[model samples]
Target: MTPPILTVRDLVVTFGTREGVLTAVNGVSFDLYLGEVLGLVGESGSGKSVTGLAILGLIDPPGQIARGSITLDGAELIGKPEEELRALRGKRLAMIFQDPMTTLNPVLRIDTQMIEAIQAHERVSGKAARERARQALARVGIPSPEERLDAYPHQFSGGMRQRVAIAIALLHRPAVLVADEPTTALDVTIQAQILAEVQSLAAETGTAMLWITHDLSVIAGFADRIAVMYAGRIVETGSVVDVLETPIHPYTAGLIGSVPSRNKRGVPLAQIPGMTPSLAKLPPGCPFSPRCPRATVTCRTTMPAETPFAGARMARCHHPLTGEPLAA
Candidate 1:
């Protein structure tokens, strides 16, 4: 088998505060292959975004990557200098933030911003860079790309701005793209279009994508594989179909069940009881025990290690559900 484009092993990220050290990500591990999309799904504060930030070496002071390895195309990134990481970023690794404004400059015209992005890592003439930027915008379904290039970010609609952000990220055709819920706020139609465009771009460029979102519906048809995270750890992972159809972990099942389509029409939606555990004061064993229905005395006393199952699946649960019904 071909080696994966990115490998993250036993990754841990922590934040130091006056109160205590809070583990934002703990022992998270996964691989992203060329042209593949891995959905990182979790509720808020489950460490999904932190894992992506750590992969890009974007975690600031007070927050640190406590341990583990992040390898992009076999190059270790854990201890690399800021200079080296900056050089690699946007050239070999790019991230699309949840907010388009985070990636765009309100004061700058789209053309100027995109041209600068292209020229930053490559020594290209201004005109050549402009052409590249125009093509990227066109590729992402921006109509009359040339005209749009002259407009500032504020001039475009939310969906259009997001498309521009995606266009900029793809300008370098970075080997990996970490998209942190870029479409969460958009309407379904716009979100679907962006997802299709991104999928096509990834296939064309052989780019591995880590799509971080709390919405399982967003990932159901988009991701090749799914990794369900909870309380700073991945509770279940497998091929999208396998994990969605037979989620062994209670948390994963809860997330899937809570989606509206899974319930009878006009019925109350299924919800996972209890809130996410506080990272600074997590329970001694499984952080999810308090919320997990299947959690037993053993689960509360000793955390279960990731156990392999059929069909390349893994779930961290001592009493994992089997053959559970996922949809109404």
Candidate 2:
């Protein structure tokens, strides 16, 4: 098997709150291989976004990576100085945030920002950088790339701004890309277009990508593997087919069942019973026990270890719903 491009082991992120130190990411682990897309799925407040931020060394004050390790191409990222991590960020690792404005400079013309991004890591001339940036815009299907380059972030529509942000992220062909729901705000047509472009770029550049979203349907056709998270931990992981078809963890099953395509016509949507537990005050045993229907005495008191299955799948549950026919 090929070596993984990125490996995260036992990652733990924490936030200092008035109540206490909240464990936002608890012992999360996964590997991303070159040219592969791994979908990280979970509900809001599940620490999905925090995991991505931890990998990129972007966690700010009051939030820190409390434990574990993030390795990129065999290099340790934990405890690396800000300057060092910043150097690696846009050149070797890049992130596409959910909001384009978070990435684009509202005060600067698009060309100025893209040129600076390229010049930050390379010794390319302004003319060369501008050419590359123009091509990137064209690659993402922007019309009149040359003309658009002269415009500011505020000039473009929301969808267009997102495409520009995506174009900037691809400028370096970084080894790994963490895209945090970058297309969620766009219309379905634009979303589909961006997904295809991103998929193709990863394949062409051999970029390892971690695409984080709450929608399983969006990932069903995009990612090579799926990792389902709940309460800051990865509860189930496997190939898209394996996990989607035979989801072992109760939470994974619940999420899959909730998709509109799996429900009967005119039937109410299936949903998990309760809200996600507070990370600051998670239960002693399984954090998900309160919402899990399969929870037993043991599940409510002792957290289960990850159980490995065939096809490189694994789930953390005392009473996994394996071998059961999933709702169609």
Compute the lDDT of residue 39 as modeled in candidate 1.
98
- Global Cα RMSD, each model: 3.3, 3.0
Which residue pairs overlap in candidate 2's backbone? none
- Score residue 275 of candidate 1 by CA lDDT: 91
Name the 10 consecutive residues with the lowest summed lDDT in model 1. 319-328
**lDDT, candidate 2, 128-240, per-residue tens:** 99999999999888999999999999889888888888888888999999999998877888889889888988788788899999999899999999999999999999999
Candidate 2's displacement at residue 292, Å, is: 1.2
Residue-wise lDDT of candidate 1 within 81-133, one digit each (tens)?
99999988999999998876556888989999899889889999999999999
Prediction 1 global C-alpha lDDT: 0.91
**Which sections of candidate 2 miss by over 4 Å?**
323-328
